[model samples]
Target: MALDVGMFEGHRVNRAAAERRCATLTTRRSVKKAHQAAWLVNAVRCVDLTTLAGDDTEGRVKRLCAKARKPLASHIEAGLGLSAGELTVGAVCVYPTMVPHAVKALEGSNIPVASVATGFPAGLMPLHLRLEEIRWAVAQGAAEIDIVINRELALTRNWQGLHDEIAAMREACGDAHMKAILATGELETLNNVYSASMVAMQAGADFIKTSTGKESVNATLPVSLTMLRALRDYGMATGHRIGFKPAGGMKQAKEALAWQILMKEELGRDWLNPDLFRFGASSMLGDIERQLEHYVTGRYADSSRHALA
Candidate 1:
């Protein structure tokens, strides 16, 4: 995780090969029956159920927390060999201002509250204020902070600046684990994505994430594969395990399994856990719940059955 400024210089991605591989990863073999049910349960465990809307409210945050707590409904939980207090999501993510509501709702539970900080989705604020926001969220009981990297730094080829910025954000995060959102859609090229990923990890990001879910093009398979390569490289170079989160536009149970398979293939089985991997998603749980219902009961349930509220 050294500040290898030129680390991304010579890396070449054969788009065809990468695309083919990603396609294969998702389509080669679908997990089914009890195994599919298990994978769905794992998907539930790896989700960072998020709400980053402008209209977010305390009541919305409470419902989100409640969903994170049980994820699967009571009867569904029992049918899947799980019980109350079991099968919760990895964490619940919300805006910095909503951290307190989420924390209060999730109090006494092991579920961690992750706050999006540093101006979030767009890190354009003064660096000082962004740092203060991180402190504010942590003070509100946020155990994890997902900070967006200034895309302009990568857009303008200021690798050093991007690295330092993430480092500062990581420092501001203090004890809360920091997830560096690269916003890959705006990076425009796999090369830039790789460079940004390297710089973020070099600066001590606990996880290098793919998007903000606000981008027009968020978290595509090829972009995700590129980032996974960077994660694997960072781990090998530093002997420290770093996490990877593919956020945005992944809403189906099948889609979650695809990403999980990609992780398993590229980073090994250890990356399948909540500690090393997460899907930053808001609507994916509903689909997974639907699929699980089909698996366990042989009846396809409506997505409405697992509504967030």
Candidate 2:
């Protein structure tokens, strides 16, 4: 697949309509009691439990990996009739320099170590350096590389430049899966989001991410809807299924339910798995674990009780 301006050049997203649809999405659909617990469990499996901070340390990454390996508390898993080692997060995401620690920590757990590379959050570094960073992370045993796109390229409508850059990064990723962060908040419009998404997928992005978790605005329902539309369109045209990740600013169990509902409705149940969708959040897991505990015990646990994630 190659870049095709015709696919998204003239595309327009109706913000109000998207907002309206999202507004009613939660209110109209209700998964109560057991069904709600099931959805929350599924969300846990698809979460990319992340830790990306300026002061990140190897100990912190290992702790996060330990959580990923055993996400649900023993009592909660037993209450739900889930076996030991049955449930785990999709991956443990961390800074590139911490990939080795994560890899060692998650060994034999079947959980992939995902590292954010390519000048993550800003992506302002030189192109060559960015590609090399991706390569280095893969060599460090990262199974997944989350690379941020240059927002300047998207803002200026340089789709060709954007596609070439992402394509090169994808090449540098070798066999590791690449999630291209669109940084949609800085792109200024849903039109740019759609176009950038198309270009990223055309360039062989395994997934199109909504943000770097560093933008002022990140992972809104309207923006996710726009990206999902592009993903669907790309799949229809190229017969390739691409994944989606919405990172940042999502910190509640309800938000996880909302996004999962959106995914099921828009892309069907097929997209509800870890391979097709992921929530990139660190604190959100605490909320989800609390909710699961409440479901099992009919009482909410303190947030600190599930703070390991």
Quick one: best TM-score, which candidate? 2
Residue 38 CA displacement from its true place in model 1, Å? 0.5
Q: Model 2 residue 127 lDDT?
A: 99
Please write out the lDDT profile of model 2 over residues 180-247, one tens digit for every residue: 99999999999899999999999999999999889999999999999999999999988989999999
> What does the lDDT come to for candidate 1?
0.90
lDDT of each candidate versus the true structure: 0.90, 0.93
Q: How many angstroms is residue 300 displaced in model 2 relative to the true structure, after the best TM-score fit?
A: 1.1
Q: In terms of TM-score, how similar is model 2 to the real structure?
A: 0.99
Candidate 2 whole-model C-alpha lDDT, 0 to 1: 0.93
Give per-model TM-scores: 0.98, 0.99
Model 1 misses residue 235 by how many Å? 1.4
Q: What is the per-residue lDDT of model 1 for residues 1-309, given as tens digits with 9 covering 90 to 100?
A: 457866677887777888888878856786879998898899899999999999999999999999998888777887888878878899999998999999999999999999999998889999999999999999999999999999899999888888888898998999999999999999988988888888898899999899999999999899899999988887777798999999999888889888988998999999999999999997989999988888778899877788987
